[model samples]
Target chain A: MTEPGRQGTPLIQLRGVERVYGQGDARVVALGGIDLDVWPGEFVALMGPSGSGKSTTMNILGCLDTPTRGSYRLGDLEVTELDGDGRALLRRYTLGFVFQGFHLLPRVTAQENVELPLVYQGVPTHERRLRARESLAQVGLSGREHHVPSELSGGQQQRVAIARAIVSQPKVLLADEPTGNLDSARSHEIMALLTRFNRERHLTIVMVTHEPDIAAYARRVVHFRDGHIERIEESS
Target chain B: MLGNALREAIRSLGRNALRSFLTVLGIVIGVGAVIAMVTLGRGATQAVSDQISSLGSNIVFLRPARGFGPGQSIIPFKVEDAQALAREVPGVVWSTPVSLRTLTVVAGNQSWSTTVVGAGEGYLEARRWEIVRGRGFLPSELRAGVAVCIIGQTVARELFGADDPIGQRMRVDKFSCEIIGLLDAKGQSAMGNDQDDIALIPLRTFQRRISGSTDVDSIQLSLADGVDNERVLQDIRLVLRERRHLSANMEDNFRLVDSKEIERTLTSTTRMLTTLLGAVAGISLLVGGIGIMNIMLVSVTERTREIGIRLAIGARAADVMLQFLVEAVVLSFLGGTIGIILALTFSFVAAQKLAFPFSPDYGIVVIAALFSGAIGIVFGFFPARRAARLDPIEALRHE
Candidate 1:
């Protein structure tokens, strides 16, 4: 479920990024002196054991959180120094996010969930409806547009979350354990969709998963241990 | 954005409708009680004013102050003193010597204990009461102490039911008196006394037949239009002083009370009660606000994951805050609206049953609604702020 589009310059850049959890005796380091770059048209998988800082690195990349110390850039924007609202606006226009839990609003219809980002953009009702319908169709959930999350199966719900993430044509897509909650069959289905989005739309993707099979779908995999990346390998 | 927020807020409430309605109940009761009490309070105040003014547009009551209160002996007034005031006092339109006694009276099949009033000529006019049927007493009938009486509507109803009492004869304590007229109904006074349960007779008839003495006490008088009640009361004081042979410097032995004074006292008393009732009801409104805050906090806690999702999807913190705040305001606003409608219906029906005045008071309705909305904002802030300030990562990870 993707579209053919152009590839541009490096979309995400991080240098010496460090994330600390607390202070003094309670202090814990999540990410330490990390340097990485994700350019347009690249599909990267992040893998790690528990508390290895892969999730923290994904959060900073997604702009859901900022590193304690880092020079972080999303395209031309200096995100590490940006305030909360600035990061929000950057996320609004430049980023799309998918969670393992498939965080489609439970009380809202699938179509409405897809229209959320545009709703924030103050899109007109007719445009929002049309675009949301198109996105739902893109995810092969056309007839299920009006169904609430609880009314759909797990795979169907994850598809709806994908529709929501990509509806706005964001510059980068961020997925944290997008297939973690699904069975093997559904997990491959979701991974195939992400791969299609990557190859066809050149949508830069940074995904975190513990599953080696899930990481295999990406062109490149970065493995982490403790608080730092152990290696970066290309699948060839 | 505002429209979206409002729609989302409404949708949020709709998701838990039973809980939302229960949450709003406190505010509804609070606002309803306040408006109802205020309307009834002012209604009672207005009713009392109307009754007092109906007594006479500009009327005063003169009575022996000595006998009316504690430790005081009876000081009687002759009918001649009423006549003297009518003839000599400035601003006096008419004066009537009044005698009131509670006694038993019987008709063919019914008997009742009621007040029998003895009043001289111009009595009804002086008291600003009306006769619905038959003629008032003639001067000759008043002077001669005829055995003729005027019945009030309640008295006639009790004695004769639907039968016209005019020209009928009823037995007084020891004698028969012919009913010459029926006074119109005056409903209940502010103090809840029935005003239509009396029978009126000539002053001389009461002094001789009922009291067995020529002694007259209370005097009721109406002043000419635009006359100062104080001036007339003072003039009557001088006339009574000279007639009773009191010394120049001594205080007159009579009491002078005006209808306006009664109205002022009634209204002031009612105003105080209205404030107190509103304050008491207002406190419950505060409780209602607290209820909103409690539910809002619960909602924020419950929807932590939703908030995180929204924030991660690029919803501003202010957007999250506004969403919660809008929900609270909508809750209280709905409660306030229901309360206003309830107050209107209740007060209208109650005023009719209680025979009190009714004013819808649109201004107060609006003010009360706004206050309820304000309460929502004030109480909802804490919970909304907590929701907005939540760390997105922690919230998304919350189980």
Candidate 2:
């Protein structure tokens, strides 16, 4: 598992993690005994087809779901043992998320949408505004802060979603099909933006996508099939 | 967190202003009706008690009971009966016999119909009535059955126009009588009767010239302070029964009504009416609450993706719950405020139209306000819980 550029402990670690839904007779395994590690500053993409458990793994990584069994650790904290509220607190302070749908509140301005994470983090209004503006500027949406999601184009809206994700300065950013709704050019722009954030801020990111071209942006790619990791590959 | 939630709630409600307003209309009507009913009811009770008090405290009305059976006949009391009761009953300070007849009186070709009350000495004192202008009847005038009368404000205004009524000659059915005094205006009785539309004459003059009989219609008795009214009433019943020669098996033909009893009855009746009206109005408030619940549930379902985004973005279940709860509460509270203002305006106008005092019951107002808030919490809880408990992934997947 050791590579030349990798050093120190993994920021996220999963050991024999499994997620099962329903009970006997109706039981289904979404993730079956998965094991993975993501080091700090790493940009890893998870690739798989439909029902291949890639989304489930991303959900677990984002602290939006819990493993039915086995230990999942984010930094030093054991995430699998945490309750809903405790997981929520971890997400609030240590993680951010970007969805496939660019789920900005339809009526809220871009500025307010970007401030949502910090609002949950209990940041004061003035600091929240400043941080939100800075985050929006980082995503190349500098003057579009007052526009509602419906008023913005799809690319602009996705940028606002990106700004919202990173406004809290979380330790990790989880993107589930982040550019699935965009055209090819827009998709490349969004990937380039993610790459820049990863390189400049040393922000760790875990992304799930089916497109090989999108996966090409990640330094390492993990392929999944039938609720288990099929193989891991290095791009260079 | 609360401030953000409140701002969010207000913005969300503002997005659908017409729907929000329509949803709260039930609450508005409910609270408005309750407040107006309670206010008018309180005013009515106040007017009744005021009229009763003006009739003097510790007073009683004694009258011959009407015959109930076909062959039975009512035997009216004579003037001597009132004097006898005053002499025989302990705690009785004074008593006066009264006879009433609705008659037309004429002065300077101005003729108007009015009630003529034939009362003996001490009648005005027993009734707590005062002479606003001119003097009361002289002792000799009452004894000699002289043709003299005291006109009430309505009669004075009707018969003499703007001119002074005292010393004016007014013609009754058959004789001319000089106006001895003018009685102060008492606007209306609890029963809504015109109290100032009457003229007062000596009992003997009414008996000799008008009715041609010696029968007294009713007697007004004023009692001494701190006297046991029940004991005095029982003594009066005994005296009347003995004087009328009623057998032990026969029922007394006289009925006595205490002013305090009438006051209690009227006050309680009005209070009961207030409660009934308030309850009927409360049903509408309940309907309003249901409306809030229905709309909130729809909101939760319609905003499923929004809730998912909020949850996925690290908002706690409690935070989401509070957001929706605050929305519902704000809607109902706004309705409650509007209802209070509308009720006050309505009650003021209604009070003027009905000729009763306008009294707003603040205690009830506050209670209704808090109750509306409680309704929000109670009805909003289910929908809020549903929103809070939504699965983030599934909700995001929802359209």
Please compute DockQ, using alpha carbons, for every candidate against the native two-chain complex.
0.76, 0.77
Give a tens-digit lDDT track for model 1, residues B252-327. Answer: 6788887788788889999999999899999889899999999999999999999998898888899999989988
Instruction: Kindly report the docking quality category of candidate 1.
Output: medium
Q: Deviation in angstroms for A213 in model 1? A: 2.9
Residue-level lDDT for A64 in candidate 1: 82
Worst 10 residues of 2 chain B by lDDT: B65-74
Native contact fraction, candidates in order: 0.71, 0.71
State in Å the error of residue B279, model 1.
Answer: 1.6
Clashes of each: 0, 0
**Which portions of model 2 miss their true places by more than 4 Å?**
A1-5, A22-27, B66-73, B246-250
Each candidate's TM vs. the true structure? 0.94, 0.95
Q: For model 1, what TM-score is found for chain B?
A: 0.93
lDDT tens readout by residue for model 2, B96-195: 9999899999999899999999989899998888999998988898899999999999999888889998888999887999998999988888777888
**i-RMS, each model, one decimal:** 0.7, 0.9
- Residue pairs that clash (backbone atoms under 3 angstroms), model 2: none
